[model samples]
Target: MLKEKLLVLVGPTAVGKTKLSLTLAERYDAEIISGDSMQVYRGMDIGTAKATTEERARVPHHMIDIHDPDYPFSVAEFQQRTEGLIRDINGRGKLPFIVGGTGLYIESVCYRFQFGQGGSDEAFRAEMQAYAEARGAEALHARLREVDPEMAEKLHPNDLRRVIRALEVHHLTGERLSEQLKGQKKQTPYELCIIGLTMDRALLYNRIEKRIDQMIEEGLVDEVRSLLNRGYGKDLVSMQGLGYKEIALFLEGRCTLDEAVELLKRNTRRFAKRQLSWFRHMQDIQWVDVTDMEKISDHLSEIHAIIAGKLTLDR
Candidate 1:
């Protein structure tokens, strides 16, 4: 049996995935499904760098603004929703294009990774949360590193939810979360064409910094403040996202606006590094160097050629 065709564009934050995705989706008659983890929350527009209203008017997008900030969106839920969206988009005789920077969420869909169904321990989860609150997120992450260094390496110390989940997996099943993931089948159920964007490390970092600055200029602090005013606590997973957390500190008087901006820039640079590292480990990505911004049409043509050759799309 033949598999459906799926097109994906992935890269670190501010590597120009959004611009490229819009052009590709328009050219290929595709509907985009956001592979981003944070973009799903409502009212997180400017900080997540979500497509503008005009962009969405040009082409349909999915899996964005579909949840409240307090909702606990897992990789499993992302996979399920994306699969459904893919089918629906394909049924309409259009391509399903996934575009974002979230690595694990995208990879789980691409490879059909089955997360282990170890039952949850509420008390254990609460205790872990308490430990993080008391000793700091790094201290909690250290406990996971003792058991699953590979996973600990992939997850940032500030990603307390996933760190706790990894520890919980070990607590319940005696098997490392990384081991469980490694043991899953690698076969994809699609004729997958993944396009990875890259650029010089220094240039990419520069772009990330500029983008964070732009976000601040575009009222990113106000966006966070609005969310907070609406009763979303800082501890919520959504509030803990890259820009939100740092800016929330400023709003709470824990830091100055300048300090928060600098922190957001620094953390985002590290995040982009981690995103690139994760994507490097995945196989069959047709990497494209997009450092030359002046020749974007040339880059688009190259990507079009790759999609045409790989997925046999009509020119």
Candidate 2:
């Protein structure tokens, strides 16, 4: 029994995964399954850097815009949905290509991570939320740092939902979230061809700043304002996403527009660094240095060869 073939493109934000993915999907007759966590939310197009309507029309895409801003989407749900999409695409004689920057989500699908059924304690979650609200997010994060430093390090203090969930998992199961992840098997049900794009750090950070500026110019602030006007609270996971969070602060008068933009750029740069760090720890990635924009065709050929050889693709 052979494993189903999966082609994955992963890299930090602003590393140009989208444009390259379009070309590869066209060439390989693949249907893309978005590996991005944020892109799953509707009405988050500008901030998430979603493929335009024109681009999406060029190739079939799945696992995007399936949820509202208030919906609570977990990594487990992402894995389940993506697995089904992969099977369906293969059934139709098309390759399944996953493209995005979300490390945990993509890695969960790639390695078939089985997150244990850690039942939630509603009271405990509420308590943690109250603690965050009263004592501030940093204080709540500090509590987690005492119990599960590794997990705390990975999560941002402002990501209160995940932080509370982590604390809840620990309280309910008496085991750290990081430990449970380590306990899971690292086996995959797919024959994976994972391509990672990379560039010089300074260059990548510059690109990230420029991209955020472009997002602002493209009405990201108004997009956040619209979601808020529709009654999506700022604390919703979707609202706390990269672009939305920063701009929401500005809209709420918590910061000036310039301050929000600068903070967004800085946070995004840190995020890209974290993304790269996470992907670096994963195994079996064929790295392509996409530092030279003029050599895109060469990079594409290089990636195509990797997929062909790894998955034994005849075409």
Candidate 3:
């Protein structure tokens, strides 16, 4: 028997998820747990587009600003923490709502993925990092392709961390990471519901561009400057996120502000496309088109019916 229940709301970035999620949470008396990878870090509020303090005060939230900027938050750690939160919410007779665009984090918990403790080899990891540094990232990625082509195809050459992880997993287990995941009999420990939001590609891109303009006006560049001024270097993983990294280049005089803004908008649009592609291939998601709304009431009514169908609520 399942021990808890979970409601997941996911979509591409800047797709109005925050507003919609708040409404749903209030209606069901649910507490929100952020599923975003970047939102976990402190002092990253503006660049990460995290929920405002006022909004958070209105409804309880978890998993945001839980760590300093330099802390490394692995997916395994996220899974463990979120499971504990879900249990607590269920025990208290409140719904648990997981809301964000982080697909890997959400999927890991939904499928109850088991990332074993023995997959690390510090010496080997060091060796792989040194190899990439010496031979270039593409060379290291090619090495990964030689062993796990399936995993390699999904990863980009510039994503050295994940590429190194794929290689490390093979070295430690002597088996492909992709194969291990495929062979596992994946199961969910909760009664789960996943809702995905989407709209026309052109319309989504326009929203993304407008959101970037708004973020700039809201001082995203100043936010990045504040973090860097406090001595958070560009080398930290947190600094490498979308808006932070791009704006950092402008602050460094490596690019003009306009160029940086354009780059951010373009990269965000591509990121949104990739997000939609990932969700499209996932199973059991009730997708809602935000463009279909002539009235806010209509959209909420549709969402309410969908959630009511999936969840057993006392109200």
Candidate 4:
């Protein structure tokens, strides 16, 4: 039984995964499938740091801008779409590369995670949703942390849907979703090579700050304004994403613009910390620390050599 080959690139945000991924994909003549949960939505380019027009023109990318901002996309849906894309890319004699910082989405594809079928309690779910609306996502997430620390660690506070589902699973089955996930086999039907990028925490945080400032300059606030003007409310999951939610608060007069930007920076830093925590526990990842690299090209060369040893190519 021949297995398809997959190259996975994952790391915390603002870690220069994008430039490195493009270089690697271009070298291997591969297509990219975004492992990001947010990049799939249309009209979310700047905030998500989507590949630029020239970059996409150079190498085909899949799983980006495929859905409306209000559309619901589960990890199951992401896994299903990624499975098909991998098969088709391999069938066409091209390599498939998965790139993003979304740990669960990436892990679901790499490990072939079988989502559990713990029955739902809609009434309970609604109650939890209302609780979140009243108190806040962070407060709701704290409840999850108490009940299921492992799942809470993986979830962002703003990920209300998954957070509620975790609480609901615990309520209905009297078992933690994380514990149920432990019973599933950790095996994949593909040859997967996962590469993780890392650097000094201080430097990475500086990068995050700079990235947010760049996003603001790139018109992220205007982008949020456009979405809201088109009736995409803050309630939409996409609007609840990092940049969108903060900017939406400013637009809605809930927070001053300065306060919103400051909060965006603070929340984004916290999110990056969580992302690093998730990757730290993952097994079999080749971590590359670019703490001293002055240019992306330098990092690209090191990554290319690493991938060349890990993945076989038909030259």
Cα lDDT computed for each candidate against the true fold: 0.91, 0.89, 0.85, 0.90
How far off is residue 295 in model 2, in Å? 1.7
State in Å the error of residue 215, model 4.
Answer: 0.8
Regions more than 4 Å wrong, model 1: none
TM-score of each: 0.97, 0.96, 0.90, 0.96
- Writing each residue's lDDT as its tens digit, candidate 4 over 1-315 gives 878999999999998888888878888989999989999999999999999999999899999999999998899999999999999999999999999998888888888898857867889988998999999999999999999999998888998898999999999888898887777677877887889999999999899999999999999999999999999989777888999999999998999988998999998888999999889888768899988867667877777787778778885
lDDT digits (tens) for residues 19-131 of candidate 1: 88998999899999999999999999999999999999999999999999999999999999999988888778899999999999999999888865798999999999999
The best candidate by TM-score is 1
Ranking by lDDT: 1, 4, 2, 3
Give me the displacement of residue 191 in model 3, in angstroms: 1.4
Better of 2 and 3 by TM-score: 2
lDDT of 2 at 253: 94
Which residues of candidate 4, in runs, are more than 4 Å off? 295-298
Q: Which digits, one per residue and each the tens of the lDDT, describe model 2 over residues 207-289?
A: 99899889989999889999999999987878878888889989989999999999999888878887888888788899999
Q: What is the Cα-based lDDT of residue 303 in candidate 3? A: 82
Candidate 2 RMSD computed on C-alpha atoms after optimal superposition onto the true structure: 1.4
lDDT of 2: 0.89
- Please identify which of the two predictions, 1 or 4, would achieve the higher TM-score against the true structure: 1
TM-score of 1: 0.97
